[model samples]
Target: MSGQVRNTTKIVFIGAGSAAFGVSFFQDLFATDELAGSTLTLVDTDPAALDRMAGLARVLNAATDRNLVIEHTTDRRAALDGAGFVINSVAIDRNRLWQLDFEIPKKHGVRHTLGENGGPGGLFFTLRTLPLIFDFARDVAELCPDALFINFSNPESRIVLALAKHTDVKVLGLCHGIFLARWFVCQILGRAEAEVEVAGAGLNHFQWLTHVREAATGRDLYPELRTREKAHDPAFTPLTRRLFHSFGLWPTCSDDHMGEYLPYGWEGGEHGFDFAGDDKNREYLKTLIDDVASGAKPVPDDWLKPSWGERAVAVIGGVLHNRHRYIESGIVCNRGAIPNLPPDLAVEVPLLVDAGGVHPVSLGPLPDAIAKLLHVQASVQQLAVEAAVHASKEIALQALLIDPVITSTDAAVALLDELWEINRPFIRPCV
Candidate 1:
């Protein structure tokens, strides 16, 4: 399939309005000729936001002479009938609910660094988001079973686990976490960015960096990382450095995320994460979407910075061209990819994407100690998914107990009651 062009490829964007994600997803499509002429169907429940992104798609494509076929809808079932790839990046009042996700956990005396990915807050966020995810997966099963379901939703690993384990729909989660691994390598080595290669396997937000080498020389960089971490400043990445010192392997994420899974995650408390600031940025993006579309705010002349494009477009392009590209990390069901993690768990590992579809690069086996640490949380994630799939409050309570932050059954009960009461309208139980 090398150099092949699927001119009529249909790629659907679900939750494009609730902002599961939207059309700049196609910046890569516009840049690559092979997929430039493909069809894009945008599905979002919000007509206003959907229309705004559709308008921006026209603005972007019009700048490129409009080679792609673009359409928008509030109906996902209608759009799913023929899409070759269904990318899900849905957010429902993400900023507001996310603020709740962070605050309510704090109120229950559970401090988490990043509430969206781990800890009790992660479980709550999963409960709110997974129902919508199940809806999309169920619809895909009925309408486009052959379509590859690529998710960019939060609690990424858990959502993938739920869909992969419960539904027969093919699914994977994509995140920029690996790029963070690459960036940290460059920072520690004092080298140019993207000049290093690193790999590890574990649940998303909890991956360990197994090795680091020079992209050009293939020289192992682990020794240097260890030396630096041994004397690293507590102010820089205390939790991450502490993990490296204790685990004998470099972890791939910052304390902001890695801390989420650790008991001492709230060590720095208000000093560590900036959820409020992050919500402000999300608000800016929301406002900018409308502003950019209406010409009230100009799209940055340099907005198309080279990122992994959230990995969806890159994987699609790689498969279309049979490029056999090595994506440093992708979230997929274990399926023996790590040989140690449960096959139903979502593990972030290196992958090869090409004509045959995406394939996980086996990490052989993670160190027993690292596996031990992750399995604790993997158990929590597995139960969380089951809770969401069955909408079983009993399972949900069990997941909360498995969370490292829930020190007492009393705290778990208080947190669950508070969260359920607050999120009642948003959470829809499938059972």
Candidate 2:
């Protein structure tokens, strides 16, 4: 892999302070041999957080012998110049704000499963997030126009659509949901995850698996998957099982994410993300980082191992080496890629990556029944993107009213008024 790259590249991470993503990203980056000697810049708003990640990166860099030229700063503009790749995972006040996003809607009688990626909550997230991301893209366009923008942000579909419609930053959204789905399929079949192959495409979290087969023989496995899924525990992934039964296409991801799109999502769970558990995990990770970075503990072997689901480093390596690699899944604009969906809508599908760019592999047309379900989301997403880009509260209201998860116009109005105020400090025109 190192032999394939002819020149060193500069890579930038816009929100590199995150405990989970920062460490995981460094792990993948250090494990890739081809990326050695590349200049890696970490940018974040929080100076202390940035310093901690920098310390960890230094420890990893020394341990792995990757010879990476590491840099850290709070100023993204200073870091963006001459960068070949920009990876962003910025979530403004992530947990605190998301809690409000869920609670406010529920208080207004809107029962949502996970408010991060759908419903009125998703609308507000779009409002708050799109402006900041567009600002980052704007800087990239001015400083390093050729850099590939890889995003790991939530409200994945909305962020991709907004960037595609309003900016020219050459963006792609990545998520591990598809891998989770593959694991789910393998679980039902009682086989190792490596033994089965699954392909799905739709919205980011709400993708439908169209092909399920044995990787060894390319044998169709969906029929047997259905049989085993029925006989298996009814308690596991109940929403996904029901959807697979009704639509004949298995949905990837679990209940919380898939439930975001439907009005009946409360059937999965009315409670939102587990902030308490997440807080605990965040603290544990911080301690681990402190210990490892300060030489109080030895580096974990797993930290130096290659990650299976993360595709950012794989993409960088592919583009640098001009390797036309087949990526399992990525988010990009749908220009007849799905045929039935709107041409401008952003859809998640397989990708082919090379020096030219990231190209969305056309899944052709989805099943009619499935397409029907996605059509509504397409409209809602379109409106939400418009609302966010223009900073139009009226359009935001319309987006919420049209959403399937938003049952009552009155509740939509109340939820919007409350959430819009809560996110007012972050909301702005992306243009």
Tens digits of per-residue lDDT for model 2 on 349-427? 9899999989888877899999999999899999999999999999999999899999899998898888888899988
lDDT of each: 0.78, 0.90
Candidate 1 lDDT over 1-431, as tens digits, reads 89864545788988777522453474555555666788888888889878977887766766666478889988789999988899888876777777777777777777677677887778878888888888888889899988889898788898888888778888878888767867876776787766788888887878888878888999998887767655655676666776777888878677778778877877635343465787677567778777877888766554443235367778887876788988878899898999887877899988999888889999789999999888898998988878776777788899989888677788788878888777777677743
Which regions of candidate 1 deviate over 4 angstroms? 1-6, 18-24, 268-275, 286-299, 429-431
- Give the candidate number with the greatest TM-score: 2
Residue 107 in candidate 1, Cα distance off native in Å = 2.0
RMSD per prediction, one decimal? 2.6, 1.4
State every prediction's TM-score relative to the real structure. Answer: 0.92, 0.98
Clashes of 1: 2
Single out the weakest 10-residue window by summed lDDT for candidate 1.
Answer: 300-309
Worst 10 residues of 2 by lDDT: 1-10
lDDT of 2 at 54: 95
lDDT of 1 at 249: 81
